[model samples]
Target: MISKLNLENILFLDIETVPETENFSDLDNTKQDLWEAKSRYQRKKDFTPDEFYDRAGIWAEFGKIICISVGYFNIEGDIRTFRVTSFYGDEIKILKDFKNLLLFHFSQTKHLLCAHNGKEFDFPYIARRMIIHNIELPYKLNLFGKKPWEVPHLDTLELWKFGDYKTYTSLKLLTNVLGIPSPKDDIDGSEVYNVYYKDNNIDRIITYCEKDTIAVAQIFLRLRGDDLLNDDEIKHI
Candidate 1:
């Protein structure tokens, strides 16, 4: 199946997000109530909304994107290098820069935005955030009326599932199964919130995001029965 698609046309991506505010206490009373309501289904009974706030980053309404790392293959003769870059900073700036990238370079209908579980998370989150920031949605990310076949989004997790909706697969597990080097050598998703909020380390988050982006691309290649890329072949820009 992967052999049918043009690898160069796919843009692999991953994002790191955090709660809009540093702490639950920072939210206005109305937002605090809203967050509590949103968390009621998922949070443990003993956990207060403030205690559960760290998980808010997974929700588009409650969180803000801090980093959006994207990668694409650059083919030159027999050499196929995967080049990665990231947009980091304030939420508005990050969204705007990413939008610019899409509009300026990857605007073609043949271009695709690929991520792990991107259909459920990264893709929609980016679209919502762009709306919040008053930035127009990039054509590739807009899927209001496009048929399933017309949507140019590729999700590695969905590809692995083969239509089984009940099972869940993490990018880490797929990488392990495919023999791709682990991207979680530093920190995982659970630690990203604290890393950004408490540690005030956006660079670290960008690094982690970039690794995940690369992992997604590698996993896609593996699905195509291709060899994993070496470190020297990964260009960071």
Candidate 2:
């Protein structure tokens, strides 16, 4: 089924997120209490909510998207290139720009969104954040009232699972095993918060996001029995 889908019709995306506040202390009294309740089960008795705050970005309610890098294929005669770009800076602007892209371009029935763990993470995360920010949900991102088969989002991780849902595989590991070039050359997910907040390196984070997006597309191509893209074939727009 994947082999039949056109690669150019899919929008490969990856997002970088960070806690809404730089530190736990920065949260107001009400938000701090809510954070405690939200994180209590995960933090356990040994770890306080504030101590576990570094991972706040995993939850849309507690965090905000800082960057969303997207890649898509373009063909001109016999030439093929994958153009990548990023929507970043102010969260509202990021969400708006991304929404606009979906509404204006990828809104067609055949268009789809692809990400490594998009079904479980990226897709839903973006939707939740958009609702939180009061941004209108584009047709591609809005899943409400849609049946499972109607959803156009694709998750490479789910495809890799192939009915074994008990375990998980990172994009990095899958790429390594499938012989696709690793995208983790700079940093992994664990360091994103620090890189964004402490080092203040948004460009570095954008690069990492774009790499992951390209890797997602590459992984999908590999799954479909196609050749992996060369570095020279990737262009940042």
Candidate 3:
């Protein structure tokens, strides 16, 4: 099914998020209590809610999107180009810009959004954040009443699972095994919080996010038994 799909109709993307604030104390009293409850099982006995706050970005309720990098194929004649772009900075602006992209261009019934681990993370995370900001969900993101086969989304991690159900594969690990260039050369997901808060570097995070987006597209091409995209064919717009 993947091989028969049109690459031009798919939008590949990845997101980078950080806790809504720099510290756990930055949250209101009510939110702090909610954090403690939300993170209890994951943090375990090793870390307090404050100590585990760095990872709050994993949840849509606690974190805010700082960057969303997306890539789509632009084909003209025999030329192939994967145009990449990002919407970063203010969370509201970011969400609005993404929604605009979806509505104006990629909102068709044949269009689909693709991301790594998207079904579990990226897709829902975007939707939840948009709702928090009161941004209307785009057709691609709104899944309120959609049946299983009616959803217009694709996940690289889920594709790799192939009904294993228990398998989990990191993008870095998958790229390494599949002969695609690793997207984890520099900082990884774990280091994003510090890079954004402590180091005050968002450009680095944006670059990383775009790399992952490209890696996802490459992984999809590999899954379809297609040739990998060359460096010259990737354009950051």
Candidate 4:
């Protein structure tokens, strides 16, 4: 039988992305005119079914990646307090910094990177954007050519397969099911883009990302057979 993995070496990360908009100006007048003409095209149809309109609007406006907030439990610290580090700035710079931090942590210890829908969205999105920025991907983020089962990824959504693949569960829903209070009140993923663009508030984006990180952490705790946090243990972003 395979041994159960330890949670001490795991890293839980979450990223908020927006679409690329800088190159829109580089398009010729004809292309620009065409884009302008297409602006009224039903915005709803433009996004993936799983994506929210607010998220799509963010991509439509101020490009993507307003913030990435990461939370991890320090194994060395006896108290179970989670430490958080957030990057909020120019998308490119924040990505670079986040990537570096990930790489640095990986280099020091063998960690199982965990996220909610990381396998489908967060991981690939970060990799693609890194390639766009000509940034080197850390070894942990480089999962190209690996078979699905061979990759060391723990997507909570994927783990839910044991319950029912057909029944999709949002992170918030899973948190509640696991007896962990949801920390999604401050701002949601949908409002991230609008908060960054219309409201000019990157802090909201950070809070949103932080909540996701905590949610993922709770999921990780449950998977490890540890006592999941109750309402008292839950922290607001």
RMSD of each: 0.9, 0.9, 0.6, 5.0
Candidate 3 vs candidate 4: the lDDT winner is 3
Expressed as tens digits, the lDDT of each residue in 116-209 for candidate 2 is 9899899999999999998889999888899999999999999999989998999999999999888999999999999999999999999999
Model 3: number of backbone collisions: 0
Off by over 4 Å in 3: none
| Model 1 alpha-carbon drift over 4 Å, by segment | none
What is the Å distance of residue 197 in model 3 from its true position?
A: 0.4
Model 2, residue pairs in steric clash: none
When 2 and 4 are scored with lDDT, the better candidate is 2
**TM-score-based ranking, best first?**
3, 1, 2, 4
lDDT (Cα, tens digit) per residue for candidate 3, span 27-116: 999999999999999989999999999999999999999999999999899899999999999999999999999999998999999999
Error of 1 at 71 (Å): 0.4
Candidate 3, residue 235: CA error in Å?
A: 0.4
Over all chains combined, what TM-score does candidate 3 have? Answer: 0.99
Stretches of candidate 2 above 4 Å error? none
- Highest TM-score: which candidate? 3
Each prediction's whole-model lDDT (CA): 0.92, 0.94, 0.97, 0.68
lDDT of 4 by residue, 192-221 (tens): 556666787877777778878888888877
Candidate 3 colliding pairs = none
TM-score of 1: 0.98
lDDT, residue 8, candidate 2 = 88
